[model samples]
Target: MALSPPLRQHPSGALARRSLLVGTAAWCMGAIAGCTSGAKPPSPVGSSSFTGSRTTAVAASSSPGPELPTAVRWRPGPGEIQPAAKLAAVQLVEALGTWPNGQSGVRAAAGRAAALGIPSALAAQLAGQAGSLLPPADAAVIRVIDAQYGGILSDTASVLVVCDQPTLTGRTVRPGGTTVDVRLSRTSSGWGVTALHPAAPGPARPLDEAAREVFAQSRIELPPASAADIRSGAVHDSVLHAMLQLAGSYRLSVSVVRSGHPLDVFGTDRPSDHPLGRAFDVWRIDGHPVVDPATSRTLITEFMRAAAGAGSYNVGGPVQLTGGATANQFFSDDTHHDHVHIGFTA
Candidate 1:
């Protein structure tokens, strides 16, 4: 397929080959494709980013690859904040979006959600907005790419549900996806979904020179919605520039960019860099999920540092390191254990 943007050059002493495998499940979207990316010329890639039991690693020339599930149901690799809170968000997204044959419509979707113990009113509101079909899809699966913490606090939290939707209509399947900002509150029982904000990117616009380069770079694997954000040309140049520069070295699987993120820092009134298009989240560095205990500490640490070199003012991930122009320039917590956050001041 001929697309905008240009290929990228590999950086000196780049890390080992890495790959990103999409989860199995469908949502409502346009192109149904599994995301496959690699550096120039096919070579040995890293393990599967799937957190499930069966993981199939993929290695091919830098081109779009087939969609494969890391697992049937999504699960956090390791330490995460209020795993139940994130789980509630994921379950709700799946419930409202995914349905078996013969079970279709808002009422049916609401019933599915209510079964998960979601409040009736909340379930109805979410199901109402979940979307509907005319003849209805033979079936739709919710393929959750990655669910990372948007913010975490004592009483409230935000989860960024990044995923793709592959819908089966008749014999043909369509591919598409959207990111959702799921809000939750801490209750006596456990974390529960208080609200859901699916991404509305408006419309696509021509990409800027930098974004075009980014889109063309195979090393930088962007999920559907994130790719759309960049294609819409809303992302800041510094973000795109940093991504292009980073792509030269490490293959990055970006999870979130501007949309489907919290407006303010979780648990605080401070503004979040994401909504401003000055920040992005990386769930996998060089193919190994940051949340995975088996991923190398040295690899993640170096990547975080390199992000700083690429002009990120703030970098957060599972590892904490010292030394920067400002305090807290590099931070770590449960919210970031699952991915690396790279933020630019401009």
Candidate 2:
């Protein structure tokens, strides 16, 4: 099998982090094009303390971007692709999905994208997709949970943007969100979004005990698509049980579950544990993002070990760890560098 391909050049530590912290959609859409600052990237966690299989080719970069206005939020981890590319992927979602009171429709959404530098025609095409997805009245807010690579090579990239959305209409507020696979093409101007594919969650089904517990735990943040996966009873109880156990110690910012992820592992035909509901990915732990070089190794190591204790058959994160019951219980791979993956066999 082909291992993760080597990057032609590892970006200088200085350029590794270029994107900046942002709060509003207006700022994010404008910043993604070229507005960023140079900073030393957080140093990588070494492989000495962890173990596992299939090191993914993706590297973790801690470039910050737009965040929610509320205490409840999610952030983009360092991405597998270029920082600008990932930011653009996230910014496009924000521009299209968010709006203020009295503004909700294709015209409003398209206008936001056009202002963000997306081509006017393409912006309209993208906005045409909103349909009933956008609430007709009051304000709609979308919070990006994480932006990881769906695929990347040469000039094309697909970023899986997992997020949660809430629409406040008068006194009634609705909780909702979706996973959008944003496709971008390299352009002279910068990364340009070419398409957006949103996840279609199945109708909600009865939740099992573990699922119910995870839902009740606000600290265990779940994007709308993943919440639906658990609600549909599609996620395995073992996965839910482990999540609840993990939630006991650390606040988990889960990125993907059964929905909005490829059915198989990124570079292989081997069926992924996720689609089977046997695994989950955490982009952030206790407010420290795994992709951030500044994140403490001890924190991640303890969490991975805790996952193993919670009965995960496989635990993958940014660095390799020691003292696993099995030889490969802990691992670090490129794709997994930005998040901690807890996978169970049962």
Candidate 3:
């Protein structure tokens, strides 16, 4: 039997379904560094002992807030300019967290957001989008994990906001989040976000040259949208690198990367993770079709476990594996019978 197309689900609840689509539908309309230090040497000028790095800290003080992942780079200043700009960007993101209680609430929030540097019209549109996405009964909270300046020119700047949201799904709660790119321009008042867009995944742990070579040589073919997403660097680095690593040994065939609307699980409203750019589907491994009876289940099992080892929180395929990050991490579903789905967290 020919397998059905795999589906993706958004986890932000209803808001996720709508917002993610708004983000993509919006699309339908259409870097890095690091350092090392044998710090036995004075921890480098303004550097704090907490982060244990020479890179200048971006927070207001050395007090340390949330720890940033190794892949994220934070360069606070040559002066107060970058830090100030960063503050403006973050404020707009925070303001966007307000869940409108009703149409009136949306208008109020949009009006307030205008002060943060977003244009009134655009702010209202966003407010309307958010209002539609969120349920009236439950409010959403956004925690800014970290923010970094992507570029800073004389009059404009770009920032990437990494955040987490504790969302209510009926009575049960789950973790959900997304990264956003906010662009700001200098106005009479300071920096303000003029445009907001979903950010592509930044480097988590970059694939080594050898692994990247494997990615280039592998016969894996991704659909146009998925291919564009990968080229755009939207897929998590670890996930891409891990998949490529598998390609080095196996004749891997990929069916989907990121494109199209999210798929609701067969019997649930919860969205799959693919549209988030954190998931991929593999139809064949080592030249053996997953659905072929002659193929050893052992290969599929090993691949699933390897996915977990590669930092995936979810792996679904025709075979069930013994150990995974979560009890239901490995799933068997008719839609996935011919492919293995590997998903990662932000």
lDDT per residue for candidate 1 within 1-346, as digits (tens), equals 0010011111111111111012223321211122222432121121225444132232312333322221134555454546667766776776566654456578887776566655667667666665421126655555677888787778677777887766655555576677887766665656666666676655789877898898789999887778888877778999999999988899998988987777767655567787778888898888788777778999999999999889887888888888966776788876788888889885
Model 1 Cα displacement at 124 (Å)? 0.5
Model 2 local distance difference test score:
0.63
In candidate 1 the C-alpha lDDT for residue 46 amounts to 17
On residues 110-159, what C-alpha lDDT tens digit does candidate 3 reach at each position?
Answer: 66455444556767765554422232423333444444333345765545
Using all chains and alpha carbons, the TM-scores for the candidates as numbered come to: 0.77, 0.69, 0.39
Q: State which candidate, 1 or 2, has the greater lDDT.
A: 1
Candidate 1 local Cα displacement, residue 207, angstroms:
1.7
Query: Which pairs, if any, clash in model 3?
Result: 8-263, 8-272, 9-271, 9-272, 10-271, 27-30
Candidate with the greatest TM-score versus the true structure: 1
Model 2 Cα lDDT, one tens digit per residue, 1-346: 1122111211111111112113344443342222111342221211111232111111112334422223112333333437667777676676677665556678888887676665577778777754434646465655565676655556665567876666656656566788876666675556667666677667888777777788899889786788888888888888888888888889988887776665556545567677677888887789777777777989998998999999987888777887889878887765566778888885
User: Candidate 2, residue 283: CA error in Å?
Assistant: 1.8
- Cα distance off (Å), candidate 3, residue 148: 39
Candidates by lDDT, descending order = 1, 2, 3
Location of the lowest summed lDDT over 10 successive residues in candidate 1: 1-10
Q: Mark the regions of model 3 whose C-alpha exceeds 4 Å error after superposition.
A: 1-215, 219-223, 261-263
Q: For all candidates, what are the clash counts? A: 12, 14, 6
